[model samples]
Target: MPAEKKAYPLRISATVLEAMQRWADDELRSVNAQIEFVLRQALHNNGRLKPAKVKPLTDDDTR
Candidate 1:
């Protein structure tokens, strides 16, 4: 199951928001997703979160 999510209000400057929007667009992700992606990366880099293990794809799974 996916982890439960909690909502939090964020306040950001327009300049930074615009930059994030552009980056999110380039990566084909919503601004919220982009933000979460960046936070997750930062946490992993700081050793605060462990890396997730992904299962390898198999022919049977592809069907």
Candidate 2:
């Protein structure tokens, strides 16, 4: 599935930003992609991602 993206501004210290740039270079990903990858990884590690809920069919929709 294709992922959705939104543009947002961020503030970070130069030290952290430089470290992230170097990390992104090593991973061959844009700095923004690298940041998203790291965040998703952290969320998965902590079991923060929840499965989507499914809705049951209702009589009204049967038409």
Candidate 3:
């Protein structure tokens, strides 16, 4: 089964939001989906997003 969707609250300047909306439309993705995709790409590029080899870390390692 697919995972449940999670909601996130984001704050952005009007100009940036408008640009994002336009880009999302051009890519045929919902604004939320576009933002999530962009964020995931960035995380993966920076090695922040990776498969878990062991158990999850606590708050200390996260920082």
Candidate 4:
């Protein structure tokens, strides 16, 4: 299963929102997803979130 995402209400100026919308469209992502992607990148760049570890799965693990 994928990790769940949390939602929070955000307030921003119209100018910024418009800019984000344009960037999101250019990147082929929804506005909400684009925001999350940018925020995650920022956190990762600042060393706040360590890269997730990927482990090979066995048949039992899948079950």
Candidate 2: stretches off by over 4 Å: 50-63
Among the numbered candidates, top lDDT falls to 1
- Name the regions of candidate 4 deviating beyond 4 angstroms: 54-63
RMSD to true structure for each model, in Å: 1.7, 9.2, 11.4, 4.1
By TM-score rank, best first, the candidates go 1, 4, 2, 3
Error of 2 at 55 (Å): 23
TM-score of 3: 0.71
lDDT of 1 by residue, 8-63 (tens): 89999999999999999999999999999999999999999999887789999989
> lDDT for every model?
0.95, 0.87, 0.86, 0.91
Lowest-sum lDDT 10-residue window in model 4 = 49-58
lDDT of 4: 0.91
lDDT order of candidates, best first? Answer: 1, 4, 2, 3
User: What's the residue-level lDDT of 59 in candidate 2?
Assistant: 94
Please state the error at residue 57 of candidate 3 in Å.
33
TM-score of each: 0.84, 0.72, 0.71, 0.78
Spell out the clash pairs found in candidate 4.
none
